[model samples]
Target chain A: MSITEIIIISLIKIVIVLGITLITVAYLVYFERKIAAWAQNRIGPNRVGWQGILQPFADVFKLLLKEDIVPERANRIVHAIAPMIALFVAFTTYAVIPIGPNVNIFGYDISLVVADVNMGVLYVLALTSLGVYAITFAGWSSGSKYSLLGGIRSSAQMISYEISMGFSIGGVLLLAESLRPIDIVNSQTNLWNAIVQPIGFITFVVSAFAETNRLPFDLPEAEPELVGGFHTEYSSMKFAGFFLAEYANMVIASAMIVTLYLGGWHLPFEQSLGLSGIWLTVAQIASFFVKMGAMLFFFIWVRWSIPRFRYDQLMNLGWKVMFPLSLINIIWVAAIIMIFN
Target chain B: MSQTSNSLKKRKKDLTFWQKIYIPEIAKGLALTFKNMVRPKFTMEYPEEKFIPPPSYRGRPVLVLEETGEERCVACGLCSRVCPALAIEVQAAETEREKERYPEKFEINMLRCIFCGLCEEVCPEEAIVMSKDYELAFTNREDAIYGKDKLLTPVSQLEDRIEFLRKYK
Candidate 1:
């Protein structure tokens, strides 16, 4: 491809990914509410549209119209930039998560990812770590005690969990021998990383929940203690920015989980079925979405089922349990590699 | 320190190996909620489907209107006197009818009405009773102060409450 062609293709991919991520984030909120209501044996929102399908748009409009209040003591510039940082971190991390193998489109070969970078895994880790700054800045700049406390809790929680998360990924990188996301997915063709190293999968998932600030690990946004936590002082579209970023992060987390552990778009037993060309590519892509959807559902289901962990318990679990488990997982993977290779 | 710690001590049940692992326990909880997700929802979807409150329910208070279009209240001030919230006002006037007296002006300030059933309980005439009209909304104080016209319910519509009162009260 020429320079212009490559630029156009990359732009098209970026637009598509952004659009899909935004739409999915909106619907994910709707489904989260619906699933929560279902878990409690009550009807969820249904007034906006059929089974509340259009509720997300209504929510966006409502948020857009709300007054953006800034506190008298607030650091205005940092407060304004916090949500933007969150959104940027969330959306940019989705760039390297390959959803499908290369496919032929109008005689042009195209890969189904926004940017196929060499150190995609490292990029994702770096960007997600930057997400901590978004919350911390929001908390500190808000000039509210609740926001500050939330920021402090979030910084602590994220740093601790990220350790286990990194180690868990270490097991996968050991087998794949590449930091590239596409290469990791390709390595899982024979057996998914989840099956090979169950401990790492579990630790990674728990860390992902903590990283995304989902319930059971949502100590930062502990409603009772810290009110809206890091977002206590935020309102209107700025608040919605944080909300969108959280869900978008969830999408990225699940996509990364899929890419690293669940074999990405490679359907098992596809060789025996003898699917070829365009049909095979289509099936593979669909399979990737199905895996992602299931993971997303599990995330929602767990949120409603489990209560938030106490701060002390959370720290203990991260350090005492998850860290050790992930380390063991690395050793287990090394053993498997030694035996097999 | 030991005494205080002993006082604050909890009887903690030691978890088995499987329970301590946490995964199986979490799976059990997930399974339970999944079952509930498929179970019948209890939501009434208000406005579309109204709840038929049981006769025992204490909602807004109403005066019973007889079949002959006469009010069952014989200018009784007992309800007004017994109301803890001082929500009800009744002005008695001489009447040519067999009851000999009737409420000339009756007003219930719903804003002050606590729905305690005190007015209903104190009514000797079985005239005032709690109705199932719980959906009360008002823009102003004047609108919230329900007059005799707003308070009166037909005898047939109030049969459930009256019968319940007769058997239980």
Candidate 2:
């Protein structure tokens, strides 16, 4: 492809991805409220615009109009930049996640992903780890006990959980024998990783919850203990950035889970229907999103249903339980591959 | 520790291998929540659909206007004396009626009123009773202190509550 053409294509992809991510994040919050209401036998937001469809917009506008208050003793530069870093990391990680198979678009073959890097998985892991820095910076810079403790808790929780998460991913990596997410998705055409390795899937899902700082693993922002946690001092748009980042990270986690274990865009027994060209690609992408949506629902469902684990219990589970289970999963995968091959 | 020390029989049952796995329990919980998601929502959309409180429901307090368009209050100040929140302010005036007295100025601070139904209970003439106007919103303190203009309701509107009070009280 020519330089300008490549630039144009990249720009288009960036815009499309960012737009979709933002909109999805907004609706995710709405659905979270709705589902929570249903589970608890209460009416959710439905007054603003046709069952609260415009609720998220109203929320954004309200946040924008609010005063951006910074703590008197806060490190102004770092405190301001923390949420931006979090937002940046959350959105950028979506670049390598393949939403669908390649398709011929106006004569040029285009992959659905923004970037098809060879080490896409590694890039994702790296970016997610950098997300910790944002939390830590927010906590430390805020110069408040609550924010500082929240930041400290988040870093500790993430690091411990990430170990188990990485080990669980090892089983999938062993099977695919490639770090490229597209290749991993292609390998799952016959058998999904979740089916072959249930243990790893469970641990990975748990770790993903902790990584996203969701409820049941949401000790960092446990309102009873930490107030608003790391973002306690943040108000207005700065707070919104962290809020957006958290939801966006949930999206990325769901997408990753779908791509890794649920066979990504590949659907079973679609050959009989014989979809061709653009139609086939569209079907593939739709399948991927459906899987992702199911994961997202599960995330929210688990959040509302289960109570958060105690801090000591959380550490014990991460180190004593998940870490070992993931290691065993790797061994089990290795044995299965050897026996079969 | 306290629970464990209380009684041997109160101890948690030793978890079986299957129970220890916890997957089944998690699945059960997930199934329950999923079932709830599809179940009928108990949401009552307010404003659009106001709930008609039953006859026994105690809502805002109002003075009862009789069939003759005259208030039943004797201006004895029993309601004012009984109001725990000091919500009701009654000024008695000499009247030419059979009761010989009436409230010249009757006011109830909606904000101060705790909806305890004490004033209604204390009214000797069955003059003041709770009405079904539960949607009481006031933007200012002045607006909240409802005078006779806001508190007086036609006897017909509170007949059910009146009937209920007569039967039960």
Candidate 3:
């Protein structure tokens, strides 16, 4: 394909992925509430449009109408840029994810991704780590002691969890023998990596929760302590941006889980389906979505079922538990591979 | 008998590597929460459904009356003197030549009443009692002020008083 045509195709994929991400983030909030209510034996938002499906939209409208207030002593530029950076980094991580195989679109074979970079896994890791910058900047720029403390806590929490997160991926790299996302899925043709590296999977899942700053690891945004945390001073669209970034990160984490462990875009028995043409691609895409949905549900399930961890407890669990477990898991995988190969 | 637990406490040491990870404990916590999720809820839908008041509940105050439509209160002024909230007021008047005291005006400011049933307890002739009529919301201050007729109970429930008055007369 010509360079111009490739660029156009990439643009289309970017638009589509962003659109999907936005819609999913909106509905994910609703899904979280419904699941939480069901867990707590209470009726959640059912007033808005047919079982509260439009409640998120109503919330968005309310947020938009609210006054955009920037504190007098706040660093104006940094305050404005923090949430945007967070949101941008979150949206960019989805570029490497393959929703489906190449398909004929208007007489051109168009790939179902924005970019198929060889170092997709490292790219995702790097972008996720950058998320801390947004929170840190937001806290520092707000000129408030509470925001600063929250930012510091968030950084500490994220850095500690990130070590395990990176180490957990080492197992996937060992099994797949490649850092490429598509290659990882291709390696799991016979068996999913989740079954083989169950411990690593668990570590990854826990680390993902911490990385996203979700409960029970959501101490940075603990309402009673830090109010609204780093974004406490934010208002209007700026505040909405932080919320969007959080849900978007959740979506990205779920997508990564599907890609790394559950075998992205690969059905259980692809050969048996035997249906050629676009049908296989369609089935693969559907399978990818199903895995992503299941992971998202698990995220919401854990959030509602558990209480937020205390700061000391959270730090202890990350450093004293998850870190050591991840290390052992990596060493075990390496030893097994050495013994077999 | 208490010394039995000291042995277990002394034996409890640092957690093993596996236990420190808390995978099993986390699983247990998850199980507990999941169990709670399925259990019956404790929520109460108000407005649409009213709660059944207990037998000991002290609701609104009402004055008893005879079947002949005579007031059981004899304008005694005892309920007024004993009321802690000073909610009761009575002005006595002479009836005919008998010098029998009857209230020219009687009122009970419900907003001021503490619902302690103190007046009911202090009534010598059981002339005033609390009834199960608690839906007494009022929009205006004046509306909450209960007059003699409104505070009086129905004659049907004062059958004994009606018969006693007939026999005594």
Candidate 4:
């Protein structure tokens, strides 16, 4: 492909991915509310549209019309930039996650992912670490006690959990022998990483929940204790920015979990079925989405069922339990490779 | 201090291997919620389906307008005297009808009315009864002070509440 062609293709891919991520994020909020209501045995929002399908649009309009309040004591520039940083980190991390194998499109070979860098896994970890800065900055810049405390809690929680998260990925890296996401997905063709190393799977998932600031680890945004937490002083579309970023991060987390552990787009015993070409590619892509959707549902399910962990309990779980378990997982994976290879 | 530490250890030891892990307990909770998710919801879907309160429900106090277009109230001032919140105000005036006195002006300040049904209970003529009109909203204090026109309901409409009051009171 020529320079211009490559540029055009990359631009098209970026638009498609961004559009999909945004729409999914919007509906994810709607589903979160609906599922929460269902858990409590009450009919959720059905007034906006049929079964409240248009509830997200209504929410967006409501947020857009609200007054954007900034505290007199706030650090204006940093407060303004915090949610932007959050949104940037959430969207950019989606670039390395491959949805399907390379397909010949109009006689040009095209990979499904936007960018297929060799160190994609490292890139993801680095970007997600940067996400903590967004919350911390928002908390500190808000000039409110609640926001500051939330920021402090978020940074501590994320930093602690990221250790176990990294070690859990270490087990996958040891097995795949490549930091590239596509290579990792390709490695788990027969037996998924989840089946081979259950301990790593469990730890990685728990860490993912903590990393995304979902419930059970949502101590930073604990309403009763910290009010609105890091976003306490935020209002209008700026607050919506944080809201969008949180859900977008969830999409990325579930996608990462699917790619690393559940064998990405590959289906078990697919070769024995003797499928070929476009049909096979389509099936594989569908499988990828199905797995990702199941993971998303599981995220929502666990949220409504489990209560938030106490701060001391959270720290203990991260350090005393999760960190050691992830290390043990790495050793276990190494033993498996030694026996098999 | 030793006893406290010992009790803590015993509490820690009480949890079996599975309970300590928490995965199974979490799963059990998840299953319970999932079952509830599929079960019938209890939402009333107000506006589409209005709730018909039983006769005993004390909603909003209203004056009964008899079929002959005269109010059942003879302006005896009993309800106004018994009102704990001082919500009811009635001024008696001479009338040519056999029920010689009528309220020239009767007003109930809904803002002050606690829905305690004291006015209804103290009515000598069964004049004021609580009706099933609970949807009361007003933008200003003046609008909240319901006059005679807003407070009056046809006697046919208030039969359920009046019947309940007769049987129980």
Index of the highest-DockQ prediction: 1
Q: CAPRI verdict on model 3?
A: acceptable
Candidates sorted on DockQ, descending: 1, 4, 2, 3
Chain B TM-score for each model?
Answer: 0.90, 0.88, 0.67, 0.89
In terms of lDDT, which candidate is strongest?
A: 4
Candidate 3 regions with alpha-carbon error over 4 angstroms: A2-8, A273-277, A339-341, B1-19, B40-169
**What 10-residue stretch in candidate 1 chain B is worst by lDDT?**
B6-15
Give the better candidate number (2 or 3) by DockQ: 2
Would candidate 1 be rated incorrect, acceptable, medium or high by CAPRI criteria? high
lDDT of 1 by residue, A24-83 (tens): 999999999999999999989999988889999999999999999999999999999999
In order of appearance, the predictions have TM-scores of 0.95, 0.94, 0.80, 0.95
* Model 3 lDDT tens row, A1-341: 89998888888888899999999999998888877877888767877999898999998999999999999889999999999999999899999987777789789987677888889999999999999999999999999877888899999999999999999999999988888887888888778878878888899999999999998988777888999788888899999999999999999999999888888888888998797988888888999999999999888888876789989888888898788888888887898788878
Candidate 4, lDDT over the whole model: 0.95
Q: Where's the lowest-lDDT run of ten residues in candidate 1 chain A?
A: A269-278
Q: Against the true chain A, what TM-score does chain A of candidate 4 give?
A: 0.99
Task: Name the runs in model 1 displaced over 4 angstroms.
Answer: B1-13
lDDT of 3 at A6: 86
Candidate 2 lDDT tens digits, B1-169: 7766666444335666676666888888888888888888787877787899998888999999988889888889999999999999999899676778888999999889999999999888999999888888888899999988888888989999999999998
